[model samples]
Target: MAFADELKKLIGKGKQAAAQNSDKIEQAVDKAADFADKKTGGKYAQQIDKVQDAAKKAIPDK
Candidate 1:
């Protein structure tokens, strides 16, 4: 699948699982951000951080 499609699927799963598995969702998002950062060699660190923050906000730890 395309990257955008894969990301969409991941976000969908994260949203669906947030209520019962927030930690797992957070971990998945974190891993995604880490992979993105590594792939970009930290060039988009700020944007990645923003995305990570949004993910965390969307699925707060319980």
Candidate 2:
């Protein structure tokens, strides 16, 4: 019933959702990375790749 409890519950729900939607989330990360690559003309390809890896890593396992 407290605010901290609500916040923790929300965080848990978010992680659960992330796990359930892992595939979709990965696709989104890839799409976003591709878009950035295109806009930058692949100049920041390495950094983009690193970010993509990091994003994927941030997703919790199902």
Candidate 3:
């Protein structure tokens, strides 16, 4: 398969997996965001939260 086609297939599989386990994905996003906030000493909590929200929203609903 061509590189682009392979990438597209991989992305599709990823989306399917995300939809199957959206709750877990959101939890991981939250944990990562919290870790980032803590590492930054909460200096960017607002920005981190915005990103966290966006990430959670991006997960496709089943």
Q: Estimate each model's TM-score.
A: 0.67, 0.96, 0.79
Candidate 1 lDDT by residue in tens digits, 1-62: 69999999998777677767887788899999999999999999999999899878987445
Best by lDDT: 2
Clash-forming residue pairs, model 2: none
Model 2, runs deviating above 4 Å: none
lDDT of each: 0.87, 0.97, 0.96
lDDT of 3: 0.96
Best by the TM-score measure: 2
Query: Which of the two candidates, 1 or 3, achieves a greater lDDT against the reference?
Result: 3
Candidate 2, position 54, lDDT: 100
* Candidate 1 C-alpha error for residue 13, in Å: 12
In candidate 3, what are the lDDT values of residues 1-62, reduced to their tens digit? 69999999999999999999999999999999999999999999999999999999999999
Candidate 1 lands at a TM-score of 0.67
